[model samples]
Target: MNDNIKSFLSVLALVAVGASATLWWHDMMELRWESRRTMSEAARKDRMLAATRLLQQNGRVVNSVGSLGELIVPKVGGGTMILSGASGTALPGQAEEMLDWVRRGNTLIAEPRSLTSAEKAALAALDPSSEENDDEIEDEEEEVEEPKPAAAPASAQGKDEDKPKDDEDEEEDEEEDHTPPEPPARSYFTAVASDNKDPLTDRFGARVRRDAKACECRTEPAEEDKDKPEAIAAARRERDKTVSRLILPGKSYPLELDGGKMELVGLPNAVAPLWSDDDGGAVRVYREGKGQVVLVTNDYFSNYMLDERDHAQLLLALTELTPGRHVTIVRNLNVLPWYKALWRNYSLFLISLAGGVALMFWAAVRRFGPIIPAPKAERRSLLEHIDASGAWLWKADGGRQVLLEAAREDTLALIRRRAPALFRLPETQLWATLARDCSLPKADVSEALQQDAASHVTRFTRQIRTLQELRNHYER
Candidate 1:
């Protein structure tokens, strides 16, 4: 190849290397972003999806990655609806609309992070104190039991024999009047709490905290609940089973579906204590109007959980209990599916990026104008270089090192050019001779060069200037 061709090839090689480096760096960053997208997508699909098949069984399923209000409107026909991951943070008038849906006999199951202000306000109409007042009234009625008037004086016992039937009737009426009245029905929301003193919670009921225990498929009802209605008893049984299945499977077995652990949302006491571990109440239900609201503290119905012990049976029973055939699963309206993995839908971005890279590559291979000779490094005077170095060292807070080095260099140079015989002398003797020639005290010269330079800007400047003066005097 000709000399001109050789030169062009060298330039071309350099350009290729630079472009390759740029491409490599970009690829590395893209790989990291791609990895993160994969992880999050896997989490959403595997952890959050509750079924092997998507809402495909048993009912007219309306599945949406949107809020309850957006997916189902007001007076939407009654059905079994589940809103999982519900933070209770609604958009606009959604909360009111939901409450209306419940009033119309639709069961709304909500999993909230805690007692939301919106829920508290809506359910506040049901007072918990009314029950206590009713109990007090019942106690007073028991105290007023009519006692048969002290038996009439013994002497008159035989005189009233004919009127005995009338007295018996009167006693019967008094006994009936003493009977305690039936207690009034009360409804309120409660949760599991160690200290149930918050007025709001107290106004409702102290939250129950159940302890953790090994998973059990079935637990006998509390003694008090054994006499409850059959339907209520069955509901409680299923609820407990479901709560046990939701408990995080510990080290012995991992739920294959790794939906992240469910956070502790407030346990709403809409239902009775149907399910409880030693730690606290796990599930509850509350009746509002003709419908009921079920609250679960964690994500017990996740796909992995659904496969755990007794979970499938509990879910089936729950579905059968619903009044309608339509089952709605509501995910948070705020979590946008597309936003979670932007890189997965990057066709347009990649196209634009590729075009930009191609354009730059083409430009690199083609010269824009006549190639000017490459500039050579301009040589500078030694003193100019030294001055530049000193300025840099000063800016970097290395003034002490620069000043000491400069003083030593001056002493050596002076010894070489003006006092050749002193070049063979020891360091101390050399410094002493330089000090004598410069009329600086030997101690001062030694201190400036051997000791540390001052850190203060003014002091450092003065010391360096003094040293420089001594060097100049010797150079002259």
Candidate 2:
């Protein structure tokens, strides 16, 4: 084959291999990321197999009744409306709806990459209760009977005398009432892919960090005498103690979508990604009721918290907040349609793939086409062409002898014609007249009479240039 054909075939073979490999690579990556590369139909059936289990575990299909029933209400277990690859603000007004659920003692298990302001506010508004240590010593357990205060100080035999001075007695009774601190308002039990110090951490434990700021608990206990009978009744003020719990799933949350873009436009200065000992930041909101926005840079209520290590703690938090009514929402890939997935789940891969295709196409079109031959330009030998070197000027007119003799006769005839009566003149006279007329410099007229072969060729070229130059001069 010609070189062009050979190269084109080689490139075509390469491209075919590349295209096949590209499709294969795409399928492989899709399998890895989207969880659909296997026998997809079978997997779908498997996820759906649990439908009956869902109905049995959670109450019933509430959605069949027109309302998504309660996404926020956590049951001993609950059914979920699982969604996948939700991009941008996936569930609009979901935050406000979630807040309403929180108020109704329901739970919202959101799996959005980045939580919205309204969503966060909904969570905060619910104020899910923190999980309390069920094993804590309660009033019944820590009673410490102590034999009814040892029958009251025996020196108190006279009841009339032992009575406290009017106002003092009344104040002592007031101070003696022992009441446990009021339980905190109900809050939310969120699942995030990331965790830092601040509201997201265990607020009762060690000092958690929030974006370089440390949040340590500082409790101010109620002031009450410990010694008196009424003193036991005296309540200690709840401590503002540092409560810290490292949210598992240590991955940074997608503040916006699966790519980690944040949803809320403005993040408060108080809340940061993580906290260190030096951090003094707090999480707060201060907008003029722009739909009650809540901004959380971290993902605390995402699917990443479902790891076995974290499941219990997350479940406990859920129970603490809403007790019997907590719902867990997860993003399930099987439920999504195939065509719509690339943009939502594999956007980066798709973009890079498009670029790769364009590059390969350009490389093929430019490097693998036929070779076209260049035009064969007419060539000329510079010196010979310029001088008409090899041409025979003598033969071009007539052969040597004929041309010479004809020139001699033409010149004689011309002389006779010009001289009028010279036709009858002697040979000697004719010859002399021809010589005289040759004195004129017109090469055309003079060349017609030349007889030498070599001289004719030389004179013909020279004669042509000279006569043409004269004619050009006359014309100009």
Candidate 3:
């Protein structure tokens, strides 16, 4: 089966491989922390360790979960991110605008999946047990119940007396406004195509890397976690279309022409925009003058080594070469040129690439060679016949006649226009000379000068027919 139809089978195999890789990589990318709480100290340490490992590798990796203080510390400690999560240092401040950091240049390289077993186990250990919450239960036991029959009925009037008149008056109005309402957020967003058609994408290309980052939003809970349900809700398997665009500063990325707009802020040099199909995750970046984001419908970047998933390696490789270059990857990585791959045993791809080059050469043959189509005995249409006849006549400066009668009429017209003294000679002899000299019938010549068709009966069907008739009638 492997050898029988290698080329045909290659097409099927390659297509299946591409689809499988796309889908598999997406699922691998779907591996994201589901927790909304801040990362537990351990998870943070794990992230730091991972970052430290990358730093130790003396190269780099794009940490999508790059929002932790632990992770950012490496960059701060000589590892530099395009943006920070810490306040005042260009990170989204830990205060109310935490998500705003994501608006800046940040891609959160987070832990895979929600709370790790270690984190959950640690949380379980640290959680207040029933015994630990005993004080709270006892405190609840002393609840201020409805005027109960525990002789507390005797205290009803006293309780009413305890209610202060000023306090009651303070609760009078629900309509009283204490603070101003916050401004409504802009609802529209633009989608910049990853096709690199926009001018602002000039900085992005394959091979560019940035020690840039994302909002340090933690997945583990603090004492309380509010983003949990929302996190689970995010996993509701629905397609999210609210993706922000990548653009330069001050350039308005308009989602709708009515001017509902967004600004392209800071983006990591490593985190260039790539078109991933159906990835539902988001990577938000915000800078002082620009804010750009690329959300995923599915995870296209895999967590494994490049050897494991070529597509992910391509993502990394693409970002590396992506700087200031216009790259169009026309083929998939069904195989690579690495030294250890068994698939490289077959040189069919090389053969195919060579085939493509041969095709190009074949295509070029037309541009350099003669342009006229090879002649064949195909029937010509009437319109084509007229054009061909005109072209033939143009190439040769001969008779204007299409038939013998036209030649006769043309001679008569010329004679009429000249009206030389020759036309004043004997009419029959003049006609005979015209017939002999110009290959027009004597009868046809007279017919042409006459106002009516019935004057002379000979008709010219072809040039030769007129010439023959004229020759037979003339003495010469």
Q: Which is the leading candidate under lDDT?
A: 1
Model 3: per-residue Cα lDDT over 1-476, one tens digit each: 66768888888999999999999998887777675635456544432333334333645543434333223232221112222211122122321132343334332221111122232334336553522333333343354332364555667868767989886567554434563654432211111122112212222321111111111111233434435786555433221222323322233441111001111222223343433222112232212223332322122332222122223332333233222211111111112345423334446777788899999999997899568888789887999997787668544544233333454565555565654565777888886777666666677656544423222223423433544454444323
Lowest lDDT sum, 10 consecutive residues, model 1, at 254-263
Sort by TM-score, top down from the best: 1, 2, 3
Q: How would you encode candidate 1's per-residue C-alpha lDDT over 223-314 as one tens digit per residue?
A: 88776798576855555443432233122331221112222323246334333332334444556567655555555566545665554444
Per-residue lDDT, model 2, residue 427, is 53
Instruction: Report the candidate with higher TM-score, 2 versus 3.
Output: 2
**Candidate whose TM-score is highest:** 1
RMSD per prediction, one decimal? Answer: 36.6, 30.7, 34.1
Instruction: Provide the TM-score for each candidate, comma-separated.
Output: 0.31, 0.21, 0.18
| lDDT of prediction 3 | 0.36
What lDDT does each candidate get? 0.54, 0.37, 0.36
Clashes of each: 22, 51, 49
Worst 10 residues of 3 by lDDT: 254-263
Output the TM-score of candidate 2. 0.21
State which candidate, 1 or 3, has the greater TM-score. 1
Better of 1 and 2 by lDDT: 1
